[model samples]
Target: MSDTYAARAWLAAADPDPAHAELWLTYTGVALMPLGTNWSAVRVQERQGLRVASLNGPAIHDGPARAVYFLVPTEADWPGGMGELLGGPSCWLGVPAPERVEPPGIYWLTPPDGSGLLVDPVALLAALCEDGADR
Candidate 1:
């Protein structure tokens, strides 16, 4: 069988810092791709209109589930950090993926005021970290 883990879809958040990200991964049973490897291994997105209640698994393709959502830090309107984002039935933070860990998948984006079109993480990383951006 494939080496993928089976899990219900859900939004997960890292502390956006090295130490907290590490601890979050460990305590939640999610696998870490190592320090310098996170760029290529872990998927990240800005944010979107994903309904938090419907997340059940990865999307039909190599991307995020339709119901998954994320917070973006690069937006000029971004409230600075996740702490400023609102959490509710559709958005959340610090929660681990539902069931088990799996290979990194697509991450969807959301805006700062919790509005607007989603930003692609790949594009954001490329513009921001030109030196080590993932393809």
Candidate 2:
């Protein structure tokens, strides 16, 4: 199967009902690292400067919570002090359909490109720390 198809299928499998909806509860293989909106916005802008699409990975802008959730590999050892890392069997992320980019609700800050790429945890931590110090 193509990467896009496989990725969509995997995401869809997370939903128990799997119906067409604005959001679905999905269990991702990657850990969800939620950072404050300000910090995440800065990181996103910085990553965009590199002009490498995959470097930013898949991220969600949770409008209600005012946070950005960055998807990182499950094995990545991110420091808890940096942000809350939600993963494993108990955590379920509210994922928007691949097409949901606009927002009156939760939306993608950086949507998945179907390459299965994820943000670099090391780079993320470095950026957060550097930016955190300023704020």
Candidate 3:
């Protein structure tokens, strides 16, 4: 799939480190659920020199589609703080499910607490930022 303007800008925002952009655009959708707001009113903002894309959509209730994609800015980056902030399980980006694992290459989030709104990772993440997240 060709990259959209937003995708390009998003990647550029990542600047010297485009890894997150790559993951977001290639493997998983990235939804930036900003602080002080519900998932419904997600808004994009620049944080620490990164373009945060906030996405929204109906949650997908299925075994393989109940995950969100997030880019770890650094190898040390994880969802511990974000999860604690959200007062729920920390949503750390986990390894991509094996091809043998049904969906194949679908990014997985960690903790697997199994009790949150079932959201479409692709829509939730891709729906943000001018539809660049979609393919």
Candidate 4:
């Protein structure tokens, strides 16, 4: 199987550290899940300074595809804040956005509980690196 989108990387010196990036991705994905039920994983690589990408489409349900790609400048820099977003209370009650898009799927930074959004860029890049090695 092949994909419609094809992004590539050129690896060399000055690449981001893979160990730190992978740990951050794994930690954040687990931490970011609502109710500690984050059903996701993280992967990282070094091509352009801590790059991340997702290889699979999110489990979509009942609506349009909801996940969006974002350039997280702090992806390699975010602390363990993903858990805070999931475990903490909202600034307001009955916020509609998170609730609406949750089931559809999304990739969000600091997204709310059951938001049905995820961040898998690091995972994507990890897969790419693996595929590159396989090739």
Candidate 5:
């Protein structure tokens, strides 16, 4: 199977009903770094010179909430002590089906591209700090 297809399947497996477009609880293979606010999350994306759809890795946005979750490798060290790092066997993340990119519920802000690319922690921290300093 193609990488994209495999990646899609892997994510879809997380959903109890892969046939339906809905959010499901799944244990993430990656560590989830949640930004405190959507505003800051967007700022970090902008700093990376990437549009929402062009983010290097998968990111999830909680509906009507200030939170955004950036997916990074599970083995990655914490990102400079910035955000809370949630991962490991005990952590469960709400993941939307691979096809759920639009709103009405939790969705992918940036879907995985199958290359397993992830957001750089150092860059994320730098962007966040820059945004904070600008305030």
Candidate 6:
């Protein structure tokens, strides 16, 4: 499962000063990965798309979907602290994976800009954190 997740993003502090605990945590993962962006501060875009299957209880798999977006800042917030979010649908954020082991489509929060937050897949069953914990 871990090996199934190859693509990733790693965010880091714009400055060299002591970064916030939260910021450091983000950089630890998102700062060292490749991404696609024209004008932005920092973001976590889904490269492998998403999987929405009612049979599997709606999961985030390494497959393709109809619509793929981002969790950018609003128009007014664009190029600002948060860098105006445009796509990266929030539904894929904390889907029993990202934010936490909840379930299919459910996003309750969106952190700040220049922050590190993305999604991946664990094909192997044994690698799942909340395997039988659901049933």
What are the lDDT figures for the candidates, one per model? Answer: 0.29, 0.54, 0.29, 0.27, 0.51, 0.25
Cα lDDT tens digits for candidate 6, 1-135? 231121111122222232442343344322211112311212212331221121121123222322223322222133322211333222112111133222233321222222233322222122222333442
Model 3: per-residue Cα lDDT over 1-135, one tens digit each: 222443334332432345554454445544222222222211122231122223222121113433333332122222231211121233322223111123343422221112223233334333342343332
Model 6, which residues run further than 4 Å from truth? 1-10, 14-18, 21-135
- lDDT string for model 4 (1-135, tens) is 111111101100012343443343344321122211223222122232122223233321212322233222122333332211222232211111222334323323223322233445555455445666665
Best by lDDT: 2
Ranking by lDDT: 2, 5, 1, 3, 4, 6
Worst 10 residues of 4 by lDDT: 4-13
Q: Give the lowest summed-lDDT range of ten residues in model 5.
A: 31-40
RMSD after Cα superposition, model 2: 7.8
**Per-residue lDDT of model 1, residues 55-133, tens digit only:** 2222111233423333333322332222133332343233333333333553212211112223344443334344233
Better of 2 and 6 by lDDT: 2
lDDT of predicted model 4? 0.27
Alpha-carbon RMSD to native, per candidate: 14.0, 7.8, 15.0, 17.4, 7.7, 14.6
Give the per-residue Cα lDDT of candidate 4 at 78. 30
lDDT of 5 by residue, 1-135 (tens): 775465566555443454341222233223222222111132223223232334466777665554666766555566544455665445556555545677777677777665656666555556556656665
In model 4, which regions exceed 4 Å deviation? 1-114
Provide the clash count, candidate 5: 0
- Give the deviation of candidate 4 from the true structure as CA RMSD: 17.4
Q: Give the TM-score of candidate 1.
A: 0.24
Worst 10 residues of 3 by lDDT: 40-49
Of the candidates shown, which would achieve the greatest TM-score relative to the real structure?
2
